[model samples]
Structure formats: C-alpha cells, structure tokens
Target: MANVLVCIKRVPDLGGEIRLTADAMGVDDSSLGHTVSPHEEAAVELAIQTAKDTGGEATVLTLGSEDAVEQLRNALALGCTGAVLVEADAAAYGPADVAAAVADVVRDHEAAGTSYDLVLVGNDASDTGDFQVGVRLSYLLDRPVVAGVSTLSVDGGEVTARGGSPDGGTEVYQVALPAVLTVMEGGVEPRYPSIPGRMKAKKIAIDRVTPTGEPQGSGRRRLTLPPAQPSQVTVLGEGPEAAGAVVDLLESLGVTR
Candidate 1:
C-alpha cells in the first residue's frame, strides 16, 4: 500500500438552481449546502484503494472553515484512515495560496519523519473551475505532476496513470513515486460509505493545522453564469381524441401525409 494524501475542497452543492451573490464574486452559498465534486470523490476512492493495495494509509486533507469537516468525515466514512484540517476560510484562499499551504503540510510530515508516496487532488476546482492548484503544489514541493488523470495504480516505486487526450484517445504515463496527481472522474466508480464505516469515522480524530501566512490573493474580477438555454415542450393532445391531431401534426412535418 502506498502512503497517500488526497486534497479536497468544499463547494456548494450545485444540484439545484444557482443564485449569484450581489457582488457577483460568487454564488449565494449562504443558503446552499456543501459537498465535494464527483472528481474529488473518485480521488478519495482511489486514495483508499491505493493505500490498501500498497499496505499504507490514506489521509484526507482540506483547507476550509470548520464545517468542511463534514466532507472530510464523508471521505473517512468511505475508508480514509486519517484526516487533517487546515483551518482557514477557503473562499479567501486563491490557488497559489492553498497550494503553498498544502506544501507546508507535506514538509511538516517529512520533518516529522514521515512521508507520503502520493499526493492527489481534483483535476479542476469544484466551485471556481480553476485547474492550477495541483500544478502549483507540485512545483512548490519540487515533485513531478500528472494532471487530468482518470485512472492510476501504484506499484513499488512507480505509479501508472491513464487519462484522456485531446483527440479522444487515452494517454498513459508511468511516473516515479513521491509524485503529485490531479484526478478527473469517469475511470472508476466511487463506493458509498457503509453504516459501520460511518460510525467508525465519527470516532476517529482529525488533525488540525493553521495557515502560517496571509494569502497572496487573486486577480479574479468576477464570476458570470452563462445565459440559460431556451427550451419548450409541446403536447399534441390526449388519449383517443389525440390520434387525428397527432397524424395531422406528423403530416405538417411531412412524416405521414
């Protein structure tokens, strides 16, 4: 089993209608629930599986408010062995800021005489859709990074990854361990947490850490939602009386005259 560290973000559950904030800097998440993206869910599943395969442990980490623990616990319930919380306002941290923060944690682990063989992150951010964190983190830690990965397996000191290419083909890579990877969804199906797992996760302790410096900030101006696509549904008629109308409608379309 490989010692794995998987980073995740807490994002608004965008399943329902979205309402933008007055400043347009973000959505009105005050009333919205929170969860991780499907991509991160898969990453979590992969992390646990990788650790189990290599005889190591999987750790889930996040930089967010106190409530973000809900998501961490969700991963724990799914089988992560440990969890870490970097207490900070996630909305206030930009890609570069959080990347540095994660790097700090990695260094801390090394200084404590422990190290992880793999670091995983969602290929794209859930709320912001930014694809910069994984690359930045790997740079800060001076590790090779593979992005947009859909599947991966760890064997001894090397990890093999597969992803999609621009030409609708598959791109495969075999990189050494102590690597960073950004995972995308679709290659594997995430498993649900069992009742026993959930109960066990609730009892495990989550390690907490705080940011050491102020965020450098971002130049992002605003967020804009695309215009809604127009759609319409027409009902021809109902029951027995609709047959003639349906035939007439088809004839109007030149299908059945």
Candidate 2:
C-alpha cells in the first residue's frame, strides 16, 4: 500500500487584512486567526483521498512551534492516519532549513520501516511565500519533484501529476513512485472535520521530533508590507445626468458595445 506524507504549515488566516510585525520581519498574527495554509489544506485532502483509494496510510507532518500541533490534529480530523511534528520555531528557519528538517524526518521514518510513496506540499507557504521547500526536499530525497500540481493519481507504482500550462492547456507528468508534488489550490474541495473526527484526533498522539541541525541561514533581511492602493470616488452629476456618466464609464471599461 502506498504511504503518503503531506506537509502543512500553520499560517495566519488571510481572510482579513494582514499587518506586519513591529519590526516588519513577520506577520502580526496577534490579532488574526490561524489555520493551515489553503494550498496545504488541499494537499492534505489529496493525501487522505489517495490513501483511502489505495488502502494506504496518510501521514501529516509539520514544522512549527508546539502550538502547531493544532494544525496537525486538524489534518487528523480530516482523516489522516497519523501525524508528525518536527518541533521548531518556523519563523527561525528558511525554506532550505525547513526542507532539510523535513527531509530528515522522512529519512528517519523510512529507516523505521515506513517508506513514503509520495510526498505532498503546498506550492508556497501563505505567510512566507517561499516556493523552494518542495523542490529542495525532493532533491534531498533523490526523488522526482512536480510543482504547481492541480491533480494527481497513482497507478502501478507511477504517479500522474497534472498542472496548468501558460497556454491554458494541461501539462501532465508521469513520474515513478516515491515522488514529491507541490500542490496548488482548486484541485479538490477540502472536507470539514466532524465532531467525532475532532474527538478522535484529540486523542491521537503526535510523534514529535527535534530538528537535528541549526538553520544554515535564511538570507532574508526583513519583510515589507505592500503599500495600500489609492482609491477615489468620482462625483457624476445628480439624477438623469448621472446615467450618461455611468454609461460613459461602462463603455470606457469595455463593458458595453
């Protein structure tokens, strides 16, 4: 049976306005809610579905603070068979470091007689926007890597990953087993955890591991929030005169013939 590993990140909910920290080095999540990154949520769903289809095992992994276990448990509630937490301060590590740490966990698990057949990750973390983790982890694991994958399936030890092309067509890649894929959102709708699922997840033990080595270096100086876009409201004439202005605006916007 195929063993799939889906990596997730705990990030501030992006549904609200985002603000930077005092030093502008990170997000000001103090006033925001937290959840798994949207793309990673899809990855988790894909992993669970694949495992269910193949009669395999789906494991969720995360690298973050102890509190991040909440995110891991959320995956369990969604039907992952197991969970792992590489306990660390996510903000202190860069993409390379996170990749290395995750690679270490995969190796350890494999050595312990659980070799993963597939590894799924989000295309990029919501907060950091770093897109290198999946590729770096694949390189470290000596496996084929597919990024921006929207759909995937496994057959006879092969994985078919489909993604979008610039020309609006689909790009499909068939790779051997034990591959890595960076999943994007919109491939499938993530299911909500039921009350019973949450209760079971709360009882599941999360395997926690400490990172083996220090971060090599992030090469990041600081974060800068984008400036807000300027907006203006034009005053058209009152009553009937406004209709002509509205029509003119619609035509200018190419909304009218």
Model 1 poorest 10 in a row by lDDT = 228-237
Stretch of 10 with least lDDT, candidate 2: 225-234
Error of 1 at 194 (Å): 0.6
How close to the true structure is residue 30 of candidate 2, measured as C-alpha lDDT? 90
- Report residue 182 deviation for candidate 1 (angstroms): 0.4
Residues 160-204, model 2: lDDT tens digits:
999889998889999999899999988789999999999999999
**lDDT of candidates 1 onward, in order:** 0.92, 0.91
Q: CA lDDT of 109 in candidate 2?
A: 93
User: What's the CA error at residue 38 for candidate 2, in Å?
Assistant: 1.8
- TM-score versus the correct structure, for each prediction: 0.89, 0.92
Each candidate: RMSD: 3.0, 2.5
- State the local distance difference test value for candidate 2: 0.91
Clashing pairs in 1: 1-54, 1-55
Off by over 4 Å in 2: 228-231, 234-245, 252-254
